[model samples]
Target: MFELHLRQKSTAFQIEKRCKALAKVIKARRAPPWPCVPTPELPAKVVSDALIECYLRTNETLLRVLHIPSFRRDYEAVWSPDSNPDPTFLVLLKLVLAIGATTYDESFSLRPSAVRWVYEAHTWLSAPDFKHRLGIPSLQANILLLIARQATGVGEDLVWASVGSTLRIAMYMGLHRDPAGLGPSTTTPMVAEMRRRLWNTILEIALESSLNSGGAPLISLDHFDTEPPGNFDDDQLTGAEGEVLVPKPDGTFSQTTTAIALRSMFPQRLAIVKYLNDLSSRGSYAETLKLDTELRAAYKTLTRTLQTCKTPTNGPSDLELRAVDLLLRHYFVALHLPFFAPALKETEFAFSRRVVVESALRLWRAAFPVPLSQLPTIDDPLARVAISGSGYFRTIAVQASIVIAVELTSLMREEESLGLGPVEVRPDLLTALDDFKVWSWKGMETGETNTKGYLVACLVWAQVDAMRKGMVEEEWVMEVVKAAEEAETRCLGLLEEIEARGRQPQDAPFGTATQGVGGDAVVTPDFGVGDWDYMMSDVLFNTAGDPLSWVFQ
Candidate 1:
């Protein structure tokens, strides 16, 4: 039903108008149908439970997308439903409820209707005239919906593309740029600060999408002059007037500035992503070291209270700990982007072996399963910071596993040249592959059409899952050559299955295709997933002479 062509469009002024019109047409087609709902008013208990789940669990862990400390105040006003209704707020409330419902299993009595509640929120969001009301709350609602898709476990991934409208609408409303030039009415310190936070949030989301979507963000520093959000929480300001600085989320002043700690790092990290986007033009290692120093300098310049990522001798506040975790994952993102540089591709291993190994270690710490005593929040047995994550975190897991595996082989090959210590990837690599398979299953069980996990399974030979299948340990770790051959044969079979599916004439799925975030790369009709035509052996085997270092040294 759709063509999946990867074309490079020339930058020219000639087709700007035509491009805009075509975009609108495609977006309109992507819109969901008028969603059905019973009513916006739900019982106070249901509402309370959901908000509690959101703040205590979802907000901190999976969906740290909101200005929670402030949004909580606004959310409280209409949470009981005695006031006049606003459509945007209503959407936010419903999505909050949807994410709340997903925190538990279906056996809970209120869950089925939560499904209806989610669609009801979309109904308000999808209203034709709703575009006219796009503003701060609308942007908030769109981001919440996007986060909830992964948090709730029932929503589809491509459906998350609905935020494409939010990005555009926010741009059209001029939320991307600071409104200082608009008028005095738009220039209040309070309003100025709000614009900064919202704009930065949009930038962060756009940048995140760009990573997997392979598309550049609609927002760039060149187009926007908005300053970074101030460190204050929402209650510090009253209406258009602003005052009252708070150093922490709990209204105490130890040192760490509340809320915007993560936001502050967005620009530097985003620039790194863009810089590494082109494989052909990797700067020299010295250039990377300079960029690395610059990035670390920005990080180090933060106040001591802001350095919560260092595992303080005194325990950190929950908010500070979350910041620590988030910063670590983002650091790996910055560290690994350059590994994708073209120069790395010239060699059998990823471009930068040192950064790859370092990133893999750090990311493993971020997403790796920890003992219960080490977990920041352990309210429920099933809850995990990474469990509710969208594929991004798990994608990191897969990348780390593969990269570490590459390191193992590379070390074995270069043992004579570089006297590197022995490396063992069995446990960490097994864990990473396990995490990947878990997420791939969740993505599918929650209504995924792509059989992505099937592909990841080919990598480790399901070594972890083999125990579940009653296979003895020796069966999986058999001699390397036979394992490689079997992996090749199995991979070919999976590729053939995909090829067969492509050949069949099938109707397009109901909604309009979600355009991928990538503007430069080719995409599958389903979006970023591409044809797995290159054999699995491409990644599975690497050697100096033998060319098949499947096992570690």
Candidate 2:
């Protein structure tokens, strides 16, 4: 039933004959030896479980965004190094091997060696002549290295240096410009196609890193004419004129690939956001609303695979993880669009307070199916992409917690305004906060304790006391609202204090912080957007001046 998952399997019989002749030479003139680092050199013949783990980890996680060329030939080259020893390719292969060892399987007993391999790969890059070897191929190594750092869950900012350099290197290669647009140019079809794939990969990495870390993109969309990758296997693609090939498989994304649907969807969505960012003046409310709709439409258009997952119970299979990854992209769009709303807007604006609350609720609910409490570690499938890099799961949970808490109090106020007796607070609101706490404990394990606790703590307590009304139903008092405000202020103040002390704020609930090595501040998650951003997703409200920001219509 399993079709050809990897091309290497399909062609092994034919390749083995050619490989036998080459292996003799590779065995004689073995790979460039770095004796100091303890990571083992790759063997020229059959790969062990260790290499498979590396390839699996690298392919599953990094290829979520990094779309590189075909692996079969490149991999064969690794086995036949004497035929062509591309150092940059070697560096990329090592990084992939390193990541596999570090992240692919927790049950994988070879973890210590995976960690060693990561260092060995870095040492390979640190060699004195590495600079001289920098070229387009080196871009692939740099990206893989960044991904390895991210996958290790100790994501730091050492990648910023890599990112900044990657943009420049891509520019030098004319990767930002489409070769197809180059009328009268004679660049071969194979080369042009490869450049297109690599460029899109760089953009995904750049956009994700920028948005997640609050860093600016290395290159803007306006500069690039390169197209998203075609929905075909590399074998089907050829340099010959007018050649058509196999289409992307119908159905869901592969757990091991950057799906063609995503490769197509993500770049367009990013382009919309980039356009919004570049606007010199805020667009008219109608214009802004149109843009918001565009983002949501993109989400609706995503072609998701139907993965029937039994989460945290039997755990998600690898296919289920790919399904989760695709849906998370929708969450990213949902959380982002509402960020532009001004809750106090006119009727013309579609991004109302209701839209914000609903979006937050969708995000909160999404975290449940394989919620953090059920998972054993941060490396679990549900936690890996959302938790490790952007701390997006944490951000959505806390943001939703605050918004829902505020909503409960606002409802009571509405009843009082209509001259009716005060209504009781919803039990669901209280339960949601407790659920958030359960989700947050994993983050606390990673040094994110205070921020997660403070989000709905005092607010929920205050609301519950009012709902109980000292065991007697009483009219809602303005003092309840005031108390909630004071508690929020106190929470904000505490988070500010933490930030002042140079520990990342507790306001960024549900995420961990990794101090940069040697005081470098390398891969710290910018999981630090203030909860206030959600209260003003429309971004038109000045929460600073308003007394009851969340209460606005």
Candidate 3:
């Protein structure tokens, strides 16, 4: 079902040319680093305050690594003309600003500075004596740095390693245990609760990082005794040495509410991640179904406020809800992936296939709310950056597109083999693939994974287009060749567009680049044909013998 043999030499050449050009753009975008100042300076008070506010709205609820009232005091002090904040606290602040900058403006105008802050934080953390300096602020800094990396797509490949290291450092600090068990030294109620919050945040990051990298979760349910944090507002916690802390009920939508809710299900979430990623623990279909049942039940138990975004005035922001929804849906996709291919050929596994498609469709909608055809010719720069700047969202979109493609192709093959006439492809699947092709452009600079995803979406989209034209299976290759030519044109156009935008005058109020738009040097020229041919082959055909295998994995 996956084999492709280009019958026409001209068709083969067209496919090769377009793919090579697209590959060239991918390489060019990766050529230059953003220009950096000799001494990185913080933005003005107003801008810095805006960044922190943005961070609080977007990230704090999810991470729950800080006691906001305490952090705010340090935040104000750093900006005070008479005070010099500790170097560690400054690093933490910069990482927070970097994360905020991604969502601060629609055009991602602060992205260059965001990248610089992450670099500076990395430099500080890499110091030989940094381990000796690890504290609550350092933990906050490291976690924020991980988040900032995901937002900016810098050091993305190393996130799994970085998260693992952070988890170990956290364990070293004894955060893996409940502070209540640590006796008089941990008697400060506010300090004890913050420790729990930070531990939960670290474990959650470790699990997610493991899922993203397809590795074993660094820590398991058995590894930690830290309790879920209270669903209390940061202001409710007094730093007085003997003050006792009390948590509000689950129905109350405080800042730590989402974190607490997620923490409540951490054990089940960890189980899902570990079972899916650990080869030795691979289980039967029945076991997978059982896990699925538990997951669904847990999801249903999530508070109504978290389950819906209808009342944003008293609950989590629409952004946070969408993010949480996508994450929960992703677990469904991951769980059923191993059986997705089998379900196409067997009746017993049909539920797996259905679950995969349903989850993917929901994810696509959450990631790109508008239909592809309805998207404006000149896209909204803010919406574009918000979606593209997030590595998590981009990954979801690409994965969803792959599932849509697989389902679309399977339907075509069934119709052809059964001589049942052309089957109408689902409209949502068609729109999703189209949107995914465009979305893939924003990620070209991040490198090979996205470029490969773009190619798959392009090829599958071509096949769907051909099917609509009543073309038989044998003629699909030629259509792919045609589509490849268009894709090359589109790729070049998008690259030119990016360069043009980079050259535009700065208008964002928060920050501006002091150097050229494309960074210190111009983008590199197109790579040779042979290099691209190798990339295509490496990506599309692996040892598994299935072209779609990598996408599923």
Candidate 4:
């Protein structure tokens, strides 16, 4: 019995030794685990590919990680403590990566792994506990890092989408924090840069996608899901007493009073009436024209108050008030210009024009003034003819010139339809158009640089209209042609300057060559000049041919 026991013990010891050796070998063969060293050879392309693979393979794990309180806290502490991870980021990133990878290797594509990572990150960063622990600064940093890491060409859409979410969240958080103060340090710079980049990217993507698909419809703003504010509840705010409340997407609430006011001002719901009334009492008007006037007055009054009032530097909400007022003024002006023009009497038009011109002049002179030597010789016949001895008079003259040009163009078109060679040119109308053209061109060339484009385009359109009617004399037609040529030259030169400053290559010229009046080949000017294509196109087409013939149609 003793000998048998000894043999068993010996066998057991041998077996144990072999097992230990096998365990050691297994561990040695495995990857050096925990905080695995990031691969050094991983190019951006490779990393992107790996990410996609990982996402596909371990989407659940990534999602779980994202949801984890600790992980979210850490992420928020670095990038966006106050906001949730934007879901847009995931979609955009996937799309971009898919496109980029397909470019180099068709087989390389966004997989479940990438999706998983995105979900995980989102879950982790959104936990309430994590948000509280992470400060804004840390959160912003993390956001930047996240974008930097995943912002490859393939994932640009995702990044941009994420950026939009981040901005909304940041804005909400900032507003929540102060009710008035703009949010964290990253708010201004990040928002501005993202806006600019996103705009360019969106344009390029839209154009390229359209081109590639042989006119296939491109993605639109409607494709993306935008979160509406939770506070938007019209029914809850509406009352039987005819009060209305309008909830702005930006979180502000407007109230209106009176049945007409409620319907006209907040057509969506009667609940907005109270809000409208409240704002109106503070100078908001139900009628757009009145509103514009009120807003302009508010700006002027507030500015004057700020100049005399004792307040903190950039404080007392003066600048903010002024900005809001200006925005409102511009909004009303644009809204009313189309349908309400005929309703405005001659006196009203003259008064409004005077106000606009004087206000613009005041703003310009305060910001930038011409030197004595640079000022135009007002005594000259041309200058004297342009200005009717007063600013208000000059404004009327300009308005009259525009009206005459339009009328002549209309008459000429009618005459042509009747098979008449051309319409008769009234001397007074011709003179007015020429004078306005000269005056406007002078303003474009020598006035406040800020208003140069606006003045030039306005003048160019007037000239084109006159020329198209065949009512303009040959000399005046020549002048109009010269103006067009000069405008084109100036625009090209400006574009070149911009390209030089940006260190970007010049783009190819656009449009086809068409015969001019003398049968000389003149390239139909490209509409790409000076970021004012909307205005320029009107001038080019209205004068040259049918206005409706364009891609925009």
Number of the top TM-score candidate: 3
What is the C-alpha local distance difference test score of candidate 2?
A: 0.46
Instruction: Give the worst 10-residue stretch by lDDT in candidate 4.
Output: 254-263
Candidate number achieving the greatest lDDT relative to the actual structure: 3
What C-alpha lDDT does candidate 4 achieve relative to the native structure?
A: 0.32
The lowest-lDDT stretch of 10 consecutive residues in candidate 2 is: 509-518
Per-model TM against the reference: 0.60, 0.56, 0.82, 0.28
**Which residue runs of candidate 1 sit more than 4 Å off their true CA positions?**
1-34, 41-84, 100-118, 150-164, 177-189, 240-259, 278-289, 302-305, 308-351, 369-385, 405-553
* Model 2 ranges with Cα > 4 A deviation: 1-90, 97-136, 153-162, 179-191, 214-222, 234-258, 266-268, 304-350, 371-380, 388-432, 446-553
lDDT of 4 by residue, 225-334 (tens): 22212222223332223333334332122111111111122111111222223233332224545555554555455445434433344222332233223222332323
lDDT of each: 0.47, 0.46, 0.68, 0.32
Task: For residues 375-411, write the lDDT of model 2, one tens digit per residue.
Answer: 5654554443333222334444566666766666566
- Going through the candidates in the order shown, the clash numbers are 6, 17, 1, 50
In model 1, the number of clashes is 6
Q: Candidate 1, residues 1-553: lDDT per residue as tens digits?
A: 0011101222212233333444344333323344553254544544455545644453543224444554565555544334433445555766776656544432223333445556566555555554334445555667766656545433444532655676666665565566555555434555555566666666656666566555544456677665666645445544423433433443233222433555566667666666655454465656666666666765655434454433445333554454345444555455555554443335633445556566675665555445322445434312332444343454555566566545443433344234343323446544555555444434333322234343344434443333333343355333222333443344344434434544577553323112212123321111111121111112211111232221221
Off by over 4 Å in 4: 1-135, 138-167, 171-174, 177-286, 289-301, 310-340, 343-474, 490-553
The sequence of per-residue lDDT tens digits that candidate 3 reaches over residues 77-135 is 65555553455666677888888777675456566677778777776676556433345
